[model samples]
Target chain A: MFWRKLLNIDSKIIYVVVGLALLLPVIKPVGMPVSISEEYTRRFYNYLTDIPKDAVVFFDLSFRETGEAELGSSVLPAFELLQKRGVKIVCGGQWQQAPFFMQSRLEKKAEEIGSVYGVDWVNIGYKPGGTATWRAMMEDFWKGAAGVDCNETKFDELPLMDRVRKLDKETFAAIVIWQAGTPGSGTWMQYAPDIPLLAVYMGGIGGNARYLRSGQVQAMIGGMQQAAEFEIITDCLGDATGLLDAQSLAVLVVIAFIVLGNISWIMVKRQDSLERSS
Target chain B: MNMDPLIMLEAVGTIAVLSYVWKENAAYRFFEFTAIGLVAAHSIVQTWNNYLKPTVRDRMIGDGEWYLLIPAAIGLLYYTRVMDKKFSWLARYPISISIGYSIGYSLAYSPRPFLKEFRNNFASFGHVNDYIFLLVWLLVVFYFIFTLMKKTKKTLRVTGAITRCLIMIYMGVLFGTSILGKFSRLLGRYQFLLRDWLRLI
Candidate 1:
């Protein structure tokens, strides 16, 4: 009877438990240690660190507001590192909402790091065309970006844009994308295979593991865990680090529920088998 | 309490949206529709401001590139699909062009990376992990040999079982990552409520 009741427990109870698990850590953070993965996180860090000073890098903010929490965590730290290194950045996105969320954040980070606008970084904003747009940028950056920044500031006015005439290897040292879904890093890998591609995926790291192994993607940072790992490495601790405790607790609660569910099912199945035999 | 109007509005929206997890209610419905409407409205405004406006101001008018109108007119034909049934077939012109262009572009560029992925599966045998990856890849590929499997079901039963297990494990990992993604988003909302809205943290 207990097993059957456990099996049929109200889903609302689980929701509340998980909610508490997530909430408690915010109220009092446990500061759970997050170990950085050498393969993904460290590789990503190393590539960013090794970028030569004054070189240009293209950042694709190809995630919507829904994806901001996971993928967005990596953006500020990446911007800080690149800006500190004196690397120039030209930002664009595949998603329409990308510039709205990310442009301000990038601008603020740049200010905090003492990086000048237009010279240090330029947000070309969200271009509507997908792969075709990216392909155009490869040949002629300004023309592809419709000759303006996110604010409709002409590319000619930005010193950074002057140096970044195109999106090829000679112009961009690398391309870093905060990716959520389709028309993302895959588009870059397919169209601009020559440029080294670094990705911060919101999830589906398993699916992308092959791309990393194959050397198609130079490095990758997966979800919020790696985003926290990135913050730890870069020493730009932010929301992701603070929220790890909640994440850990929520994961534990979920695992416990799964285990309880399976055990209850097995017990109930055994009881049913005995009754049937009798 | 933060009490900032923007933060207050956000808190209300967040609570309203989350309230649905307990039970569907008016607050949830109102906020849900508001979110959808806001996003749709933002998309249209952005498209106009970013792409259409710039092209018109700079390229079409400023530069006197009236030739741009030809493509613009072709694109406008897409609206005919909904405006009138008699001329709904006109949408096919733009559709075919887009499809043909995409196919051509894909054919031109997509093969190299795919071929590279295929080659890499066989390129490395230096480590135990590499060997395992190759073996698993071969097994998964072998599982899809439908005709051979039908002909020799008994002979391939063990292979099929192993392949199925590997696929299941792969799927499990994918599902786990997807859940992690969801939890991360949930954590973000929690952080916003505690830190930004309530100032509890």
Candidate 2:
């Protein structure tokens, strides 16, 4: 009778229990351990500190819709690092919603770090032609980006572009890009030859670890695990750390369920076989 | 309650995705379909912006190349399956080209990396840790070799059982990891609702 009752409870109850358990913690996060990688430190930021003040460093926002969780937290610290240093920034988009989303993230950090805009930074909106745009930016930042700014003010009017009218400034610093597949690491490497580029890919488009080791990308932070690590290293600085703790706990619970299920099923089968023999 | 209308909607949208953990119902499906539709529409627009407008448009009409029409024609072949059979053959044209180009690209790219991985696993480093890993690796590889034989031996059975157990453990870990990963997203969605939008906290 007990076994029969156990089998009879509606699956709905299970769903509600699991859902609430996962959801409640997220609303009220209990901070957990995060294991941030050394690669992100060395590859993306180590080369960045040397760039002189007011050197143009472009931040490429690569999130569209699906890749936000994996991409967002990983890039947060890097943005904070750039803002604190008082370096000039040129921001743009490779994904549609990315610019709008990152505008807020950058603005919040800028307030904290006291980085000035138009004087200290600017955002150039999206453009067509992935490879073509990279080539245009390399040859001329204004030709493809003409009459565009982070605010729709003409690109030429920006003070940051004043001395560097030709887009061929040798002193320009670096381009840090986040990638989610198309127009990925290959395109920029092919067209934009130098100016010290760094990239992070947050999705399965990385192909595999083997491709990453080929020097195509300077650095990479992938999946939720890496993002959690970044959050831990930065002392749970961003909101993403909440998700990490929830995920680790969820995994543990699921594993326990699967083992128990298999054991129960095996026991039932054994009892049935014994009864038939008797 | 505090800020922009769109931010509230985005927060609601996130909670809708998380609602699935409670039940398989209409809200989750709506969000899933909306996400899919938006992505598909966005991809089409992006392809036009990135590929069609700059390359084919400027060259086709502005420069009067006439050669751009060929690719344009091949691209239109996708609609042929609905109405006609003969035109369906055009689909092969792009597939063949894609396969050919990818083959060429990968051939040039894959050799060194492939050799490096192959050598890394097989070649012993002479360290204690390295030897232990190498021994397990070779044993696993050889255990798979037993599948080739029509008959089984006592020795093969032991190794086969060990390999099977290892595989099960690996699968269990992977399943657990996936569940945890998904729950993380659900948690984010729930947080957006409770703290950011509702401000109940």
Candidate 3:
């Protein structure tokens, strides 16, 4: 049968279906208990706590601030790990707004760690130099970025630049890359191979974050799940955990739809089979 | 006046974005365009303030460093596209340099780690944690290879099973992540509306 033609459904029905799919979960959660994957937690916490003090950590803010949904969760745990371990951070932003975006968080984070900006950590600011600049950063570490801190101070004056200036075989403990898709985790791996790349992002509103979760990445914060995990691990629940049930419920609703869709298809198939038998 | 305009803007902007589920029309288009425009403007302003004005312009004018003119001259070649047919070919130099640089840069980093990763996968044959994953990866690779020969239903079933398993895992993660992501953006808007606009939060 020509289903749409036979049924004569209104076009407005499409909107209703989508609206309900999203809204139903907001109203009522499936109340499913989520079990934390051990490997992820173990690795996430262990990978972080294992780093030694004064170990150079490269932090790349690949995405802008609005990306907090995806990246906000992932970056927190890594940041917590660094703060606790006293890792020396050499930070840079792939995005233009990175300095301003990162500055706000670091202001609080630096306070927590008793770390100073120019001494313990430094922001190299936006590198519009693109991949060419990134490659130079690998070879020279400062060819594309010789001068200027994130605060726009001369690089020679900054303490962090002392080590970075000597780029020969200098390796960071790991690189924290906050990517919101496109020129993201994949780009960092290709551009700078000096250290292990940790993928972070403010998740795209839909399916994009999952692309990082696959084994292609060594480990991931897993968007809000990652953020929630951090809160659980830290024993400090924030806005991320406050909304966890709501987020979990939303997934359950989508799964329900998939099940409903299959059931609908089977009913139609069974009815067709009955007609043929008759 | 009750709260900051930025907060109200966030709320209004968030709902405007989500309105796309009903149907993509003018409201969504307005928000979309606004976002693109804002990002472009921000990039330009930042580039000017951070790199061009401070470094390039400062160095160029300070010592009368004429050598800095080389990149500027090459960058100008991009505009030659609007001038003449003969001048259009000048653009190719910059385009070629971009392609050349990207490849040169990528080759410097990609080869070794990927080789190590490949070795890691190959080295793990019988380990419990990695064995199933390794097999699944191989099966997917085989299924995706277009020229592969499939002699029997058994071969097809194996590919189908692996593919199905991978897809199910993919969907579960995708659904969970995307939903939360959307909600966060929405919450950002609600925070704006209630806190900034209405002063009700």
Candidate 4:
């Protein structure tokens, strides 16, 4: 009976419980300690911190709107670190929707820092041709970037672009990729294999592991756990840390449900077996 | 209580989308359709502006790169698929070209990076962690070997069993991490609902 009750509970009830678990924390903050288990996040943080000012870095903001909640939180703090260091960034998007996210972040933080467009930073916007686009960018940077910045300004007009003509180790200091899926870090890895690449993956550790195993990605932050870790480590309080409470509460609720279900199932099975044997 | 129209729409959409967790209905369907339509429209506009405008339209006329027309012609051949049977084969030309290009590109580039990593796996085991990692990696690789004969040796069988167990453990860890990832994403939607739209937090 207990097993049946546990298994057949109304789905709506579960939804309401999970919803509240997420909601209550956001409304009233509980200062839950966020643990930093991933060593790579600290490595990534340190790597980004040590990069000299005026060192041009190509950042691929390839996360679309759907990934904003998870990946965006991590990027905001990382972008702040980059801005704080005065590291010149060449932002580009492999995904079409990525530009809006990148633009909004800059409008908020970069503008406050008095960072100038085209001089201090430039956005090449969406590059359509996946691997071929990266290869082409390597072949001829301006041609591959379509010879214009994200604003449709000619590369020749941008002061930063005057020094950088192609994608190579000598031209750029490093590549930081904030990616959700393919045509992102993978494309960058395949084309620009030699460049020191840092990737923040908002996905499964399985995929992230492969890139790490292959040494294709020099550093990585794979999930919001690491994102929260990065925010705490950087001392920049942002969305990822804010949402960690809800995330942990929801996860605990689900785990509790799972454990209860398993216990009830085991008790019911034992009762049935004893009855049959008797 | 947000009075902004954009916030209002977002709040409504978020609730509508989340409503599917209980049960699907008209509100969910309406929002879903609207989202799909918006995304399709956005993609179309972006593709035309970011891709087609510069590559096809501008390059042809403004740059005098008339030679780019060859690939454009090959691309047009893909439209032959919806045409009559005689023209359908024309589609294969572009498909084959793309496939060949992809294969050659992968062959020329992919191996070195992976091999570079594979070489690192063989470096001197300086630490206990390194040895354990190498052993687990080898066992996981062994789990995939499908050539075991019906009369395989007892040691091989035991090794295979151990390999399978290790792989299962690896998979379980990865699955657990994936659940955590999804939970974070779910929390993101809630953050938007409370912080951005409702302004309650």
Q: What is the C-alpha RMSD of each candidate to the true structure, in Å?
A: 1.8, 5.9, 4.6, 2.4
Docking class of 1: medium
DockQ of each: 0.64, 0.20, 0.35, 0.54
**Candidate 1 lDDT, tens digit per residue, B40-149?**
89778777876798789988899999999999999999999997799999999999999999899888988989998889767968899988998898888888975366
Candidates 1 and 3: which is better by lDDT? 1
lDDT for each residue of candidate 2 in A1-278, tens digit (9 for 90 to 100) = 34334445466776666676666566666776555467654444456666676577777876664455556676667666666677777777776667666777777777777777677777775665554465566666665554356555765567876644433337466667766656655554444434456776652222333334444444556556666655565443665666666655555665655565566667777777888999
Better of 1 and 2 by TM-score: 1
Residue by residue across A177-209, what tens digits does model 4's lDDT show?
887776777676667778889998874355466
Give Cα distance to truth, residue B109, candidate 1, Å: 2.9
Chain A TM-score for model 2, please?
A: 0.74
Error of 3 at A46 (Å): 2.0
lDDT of 2 by residue, B1-201 (tens): 547697777876776776675667887899899988987897787556544664555556767888878877776767666667866776777778767866875575546445544565555576686676666667678777766551558777777778777667666655544454455445555655666677775
What TM-score would you give candidate 3 relative to the actual structure? 0.80
Per-candidate TM-scores read 0.95, 0.69, 0.80, 0.92
Give lDDT tens digits, candidate 1, residues A1-278: 99999999999999999999988987898988789899889999999999999889999998886677777878999999988888888888998788767888887888888999898998888887777777888888877788888888888898878898888999989999988778788888888888999998885486888888889899998877888899999999887887778878898999999999999999999999999999
Best by TM-score: 1
Which consecutive 10 residues in model 2 chain B have the weakest lDDT in total? Answer: B176-185
For model 3, the stretches where C-alpha displacement exceeds 4 angstroms are A1-36, A74-77, A97-99, A111-114, A166-171, A201-219, A272-278, B23-27, B58-65, B146-148, B151-184, B187-201
Model 4: what is its DockQ?
A: 0.54
Q: Give the alpha carbon lDDT tens digit for every residue of A34-54 in model 3.
A: 455465544556666777887
- Pick out the ten consecutive residues of candidate 2 chain A with the lowest summed lDDT: A203-212
The interface RMSD values of the models, given in order, are: 1.7, 6.0, 5.3, 2.6
Whose lDDT is higher: candidate 3's or candidate 4's? Answer: 4
Candidate ranking under TM-score, highest first, comes to 1, 4, 3, 2
